[model samples]
Target: MAEIDPDAKRRPASVKELKAMSHPLRVRIIRLCGDHELTNKQLADRLGVDPGTVYYHVRQLVDAGFLEPAEVRTGESGALEKPYRSTGRSWWLSVQLEDLDTSQGFAPVEAFQQELAEAGPASIASYARFALHLSPEDVAELDRRIVAVIDEYVETDTERAHLPAHGGIFLLHRTPD
Candidate 1:
C-alpha cells in the first residue's frame, strides 16, 4: 500500500474557482482533458457544441487554474493546434455543495450522469446496491472508511495511467419512502 502523506491536505475551493467549476459543461471538460490533451476544436466536436462555446468555458477553466495549455502540436492535417490538459487541481480542491446554488451544486453529478450514459450499460464493470440504517456516528465512520479506501487508489492513480480508465460513483442518499 502506498503511504499517504498526513500533512498533505485538500484546500477548499475559493468562490471564484467554485463558480468557475459550477457548470456541467466545465466539469465534463475537466474529465475529458484528464484522459488526454485535447484541442478546443476537438472538445467542441466531442461535446457536439459550438467551438465558441467550448472556447468560452475553456477560458474560464484556464483562468481558474483547472486547465492548462499543453505543447502546441501539428495535427494530421499538418495544422498547428494548441491542446489543453487538465491541471488536476480540482481533484485536490474540496467543494462544499451546500455553499453553492442547487443547480450549481449538481454540476459534477450531472456531468457524471452524462458521461455514464455516453459510456453505455456495456461499460459497467461492477455494481451493487443496498440500503443501510445507521446513526450519525456510524454514518460518519462509514463515510470515512470508504473515503480512505478510495483515497488509496486515487493517490496511486498515476501508476496505472496506462490502464484503461474506469469511472465509479458512490452515492449515499435517503431511501424514498
Candidate 2:
C-alpha cells in the first residue's frame, strides 16, 4: 500500500472560497479542468456560454487556489489564450451540515447532472447504493477508511494521464428514528 504524500496538504477552504464554489457553474468548471488544462474560451464553448462568463468564474476559481495557470498558447484565431488546470487537491471544509444545506447543497448534484448530460447515461459503467446502521465509532472509522481509499485514487498522478475524468461522491448521514 502506498503512503500518503508528505507534501500533500489538506486545508479547510475559506468562507470566500466556499462561497465562490457554491455556484453550479463553478463546480462544473472545476470538474472540467480536473484532467486537462483548458482556456476560458474552451470551457465557454463546452458549456455553451460566453467567454466572458467563463473568464469571470475562472478568475474566481484561480483566486480561490482551486485552479492554477497552466500555459499560454495561440488559439485558432491566432491570439494568445491562457489555460488553467485543477490543483488536484480535495478541499476540506468544516462547516456545519446545516450550512451546507443552503445554496451549496445542490452544487454537487448539479455538477453530476452536467457531467451526465455531457457523457450521456450510457457512459456510466457502475452505480450502487447502500444503507447501514453502525455505532458512532464505527461511523467515524468507516468514513476515514472510505476517504483513504478515495484519496489513494485522487493522488494518482502518472496513471491519471491515461485515465478519463471521473467523479464520485459519498454522502453519510443519520436519520431520526
Candidate 3:
C-alpha cells in the first residue's frame, strides 16, 4: 500500500462543492460510494429512499467531483449498469463548517446519526462517553491529535480492505449546564 505524505496540503472545498455536500443524504451517498460502486437504484435501495431522490443527490455529487462514473458492468441479472464510485476527493478536502450556514453545517453528523440508527446497537464494536474541562486551545489540541490518529488509519485503509468495514465518529461538544 502507498503511504501518505503527512505534510501535504489538503484542498479546500469550494462554495459550490460545500453546498452540494450540505445535505445528510449527500453525505451518506459519499460514504456509500466510498465503500463500493453503486448505481442510483442500488443507492436508493440501501438508503430506503426513492430512486428519483437518489438520482438528484448522485447528480449533485457527480457535479461536485466527489463521485465519478465507474466502468459499466453487467449486473447479476446480466443487464448493463452504470455505477458511481467515490473519487475520494472529500478525504483530501478541507471543509470549514463554521464558515457555512449554521443550518447546513451538520450534514456529516446527521448522516452519522442516521447510519448509526440503521446499524443498531448490536453493530457497535465499542463505545465511550466522557466529560472534559478544557480551554479553547486545549480543545483544539485534543481535536488535532485525535484527527491525526484517525488520518493515519484512513491513509493506510486500503491495506486492510479485506477486513470488515467499521464506522465511527468523534465529537466534543459543550455541555448544556
* Local lDDT at 144 for model 3: 70
**Model 3 TM:** 0.91
Name every residue pair that clashes in candidate 3: none
Q: Candidate 2, residue 113: CA error in Å?
A: 2.0
Q: What's the CA error at residue 75 for candidate 2, in Å?
A: 1.6
Over 1-177, each residue of candidate 3 has an lDDT whose tens digit, in order, gives: 444443354767899889888999999999999999999999999999999999999999999999999999999999999999999888777767577896577888899999999999999999999999999999877877777777888878999999999999888888999
Which lDDT values do the candidates have, in the order given? 0.87, 0.76, 0.88
Clashes by residue pair, model 1: none
Residue 132 C-alpha lDDT in model 3: 97
Ranking by TM-score: 3, 1, 2
- The residue-level lDDT of candidate 1 at 81 comes to 96
Question: Largest lDDT belongs to which candidate?
Answer: 3
Question: How do all models score by TM-score?
Answer: 0.90, 0.82, 0.91
Tell me how many clashing residue pairs each candidate has.
Answer: 0, 0, 0
Model 1, poorest ten-residue lDDT window? 1-10
